[model samples]
Target: MTFEQHISGNIEYLERPGSIGGPVLVMLHGIGSNAASFTPLLDHLPRDWRVIAWNAPGYGGSIPLDAEWPLALDYAAALKDFLDRLELKRVLLAGHSLGCLIGAAYAAAHRERVVRLLLSSPALGHGVPCGGALSAAAQARIDDLQTLGPDGFAALRAPRLVFEPESNPEIVRYVRDGMARVSLPGYPKAARMLASGRLIDDAERLQVPTDVIVGAHDVVTPPDSARRAHAALRHPWRGAFTLVPGAGHALYQQAPVAFAAALAALAETVG
Candidate 1:
């Protein structure tokens, strides 16, 4: 429940020591999500592994970022600076959704410092299907940001991402609150990054082992995109990709036990 949080380049983070040493797991949250959202997975993690979760600029407790900063380049730089500030030379970076985009870019840009990578419910922007509702929905989100600002954008999108229509009201509430807390400027710029981002290409040449976990019922990023990512990795450095059962896009919330099992197993493979 208690841990020392770090600050760098307008981002705030909390680090939890795990049962194993050597490779640390740096977890990143999705757009409109924050460090606190990973609490459930944290419980199921090993104490020996160094676990770090950060609030992306404008989400959680992190300060809002510049509206002009939409490129992954800036985010990748900030992440590098953050790690440098914390004195972590190498880490096992993991992320979900928008966080996955950042994690992939960070790993690719600083291949020397990252030992491995794990992505959950990833939305590989360039790889997202150009046709169908996924494409249409993505466009709609961008349009909404221009029209409704961040609050309205957050209100409209969080539910579709968090749960299915069949989910319980309590679960929906938890997801909604997290999305709602995100500031307007942060959300819009972050969304713009997502709309323009292309992390799968960045992950292609990565030399470290990488794992991708997807929820079978995820409508937001979907399982197909995960499969495409798994295919994109270097042959020898390829990692496992799994689609968890009975979960929507927010697998960490809808089925945290399974998500943790996958995450803990990732820890085991750190060597």
Candidate 2:
């Protein structure tokens, strides 16, 4: 399933169209990731299920947001604009790591726009209030980017995204390639959003059906964090927290079969 790249207004996304009137799935990648990062999961997904993965503002060719320190709501608004331009009335929203924050905001605020929500290795942001200084962790992301540059930053951090880098060289390289594309303004803005995001709060407010999954071996957003987020969901899809085995932070890439099966199960059984 080859994904075709398209630009709708200021947003850039990769799409793999399915049968007419089929279910639509919108994928949002993490801070270090781009739409291309979802490629590994595509082959495992059903060809008839339309999948669209966006390169959040600043990544890929998309323009950066105006606010230097944007919030999850700002990203949600961008997402709304992108969906509006596509004339999509509703969709299945899937978020990974940092993307969970943005997706949670959107799904909570625009409940009518999302039919279901799927989260992977959900990142619990720093939850700093607006106008507050960036947390040490958030600041480190920016500092590392400045100190290492894109390629170096990717090389240094990409392996950490996987459980065992030595065993998963291909996945490591893929993540590295994606992270190496991160540029200024966008990366910093996203960093600030991470500092401000409170994914659990948004999850608690969601009226839409939601499911959360994490890699059993994930160190970034470990199973415990994912469980906490799942506990916060008001309408968990199956009232369960899924942990994909033999996977890590990059579970979608590391355990594509399990990831795809979980996604398909959600679509098939969850209405």
Candidate 3:
């Protein structure tokens, strides 16, 4: 499959075109990742599926939001506009970490556009009491980036994101490279958005099918957190919660086959 850049309106994305009648899968990357982060995972998906992975606002040369610190809804609005520009009326939406926050918000706002929602290494941002801790952590991330700079921040943060960085040099390099591409001004704003996210509330309000997948060893948004997010799901729209073995926060990179398997299952079952 070939991946290339496409710009419609003001948004830029990396897209792998699919055969006619195939399902459309739109991927949203995590905070420290770009559209390229989904390459390995995309390789494991069905060849016929149309896959489009977006470099979220400010990442990978994409446009940044005008606001100093935009909310999750702001990011979701940009996503909606991107879809509209492309004329993608319906798609299977998947997201990782911070992307999950945006995906959930988008699904809540535009229920008809998303057929199914898949959240990988899901990061649920509850507001207020729990939000306080998340906000502080997000600020710390911004502070660390400011102090360390891109390369330095990637060096220190990349290894910890995976389960076994010392033994997995290749994955370490990949993660580090992705992190190094993070947009400084954009990242701080994203962190602030994450700090104020309301994913659980959105999940409760969702009317379409949704699934949550997480790596068993993920320290950042561990299995417990994924479970809690699933538990918070309200009646009719609630879906499955899966834990993939031998992976961590960067599960899509470390165990892409299993990650894709979970995603494929969701696609087949939901379709």
Candidate 4:
């Protein structure tokens, strides 16, 4: 289900080979997370698709990014290099949270190399600058990032992001423990980028067929923002938005079956 191989860059990944042999699906996790973050999604996956979850530099088992890792473009470049090394010229890109932002940027910049893009908890743009409120929120995240490192962050985040644990405490705990193990420095920078990063103006020109998956209870990136993003795309069909009821931002973990069902439905459009 997982393995380590040296591509141009050292990448830790989870690979679920599909029998159909199309472009390998490239899955990128949100910031402060790793390739293994999508275990739930993998579990629901079928053999017709080769699913690979990539650990962005400094997260999970991937090598650490340079201290001065390129902000947005640098990250995109890494993805480009990564795909090229794997000999996958074009790929189906699925990303969550900050990873969504990264995937969108890549697709927008290299339209020729992307077949489809699926975004979950996407970071379309910075939350409306709510004066001090936004700053306060960001600072709190920064503080937490510093305090929790990987494990603590996971512990704190799982309960909030995943569906109620009384519903399935052990399941939630399993995810939290993995999240908490994420790379330290990678977590804060990811948070910083999402807080101030702007992609709305750029995504206005994205060309690939794209879908935004939103969880109804997602406080991280609300549905209203998703609707705004949906309206902004030049190709509206290329950027559809779907909501997951009774789930939060990490629904792929909280409710993998539903998430896979949605993704499978989207696959039909791609075909």
Give the runs in model 3 whose Cα sits over 4 Å from its true position: 126-134, 269-271
Give the higher-TM-score candidate: 2 or 3: 2
Ranking by lDDT: 2, 3, 1, 4
Q: Judging by TM-score, tell me the better candidate of 2 and 4.
A: 2
How would the candidate models be sorted by TM-score, starting from the highest?
A: 2, 3, 4, 1
Cα lDDT computed for each candidate against the true fold: 0.75, 0.89, 0.85, 0.70
Model 2 lDDT tens row, 1-271: 6799999999999999999978899999999999998888888888889999999998888999999899999999999999999999989888999999999999889988888888889998998987798999899989999999999999998998898899989999988998999999899999999999888889889888888889999988989999989988774443457888889998888888888877775575344
Better of 2 and 4 by lDDT: 2
Candidate 2 vs candidate 3: the lDDT winner is 2
Off by more than 4 A, model 4: 1-8, 67-69, 125-135, 269-271
| RMSD for each of the candidates | 3.8, 1.3, 2.1, 3.3
TM-score of each: 0.86, 0.97, 0.94, 0.87
Candidate 4 lDDT, tens digit per residue, 1-271? 4433333566666677667665467888876567777776766766677787888876766666564323555578778887877788777788787887788788889988877788777766464342323445556766876786666767787777665666878777866777777655766556555665566765687887887788887787787776666666775445567888888777687767877876675566444
Give the least accurate 10-residue stretch of model 1, judged by summed lDDT: 126-135
Better of 1 and 3 by lDDT: 3
* Best of the candidates, TM-score: 2
The C-alpha local distance difference test score for the whole of candidate 1 amounts to 0.75
What residue pairs are clashing in model 3?
A: none
User: Total backbone clashes of model 3?
Assistant: 0
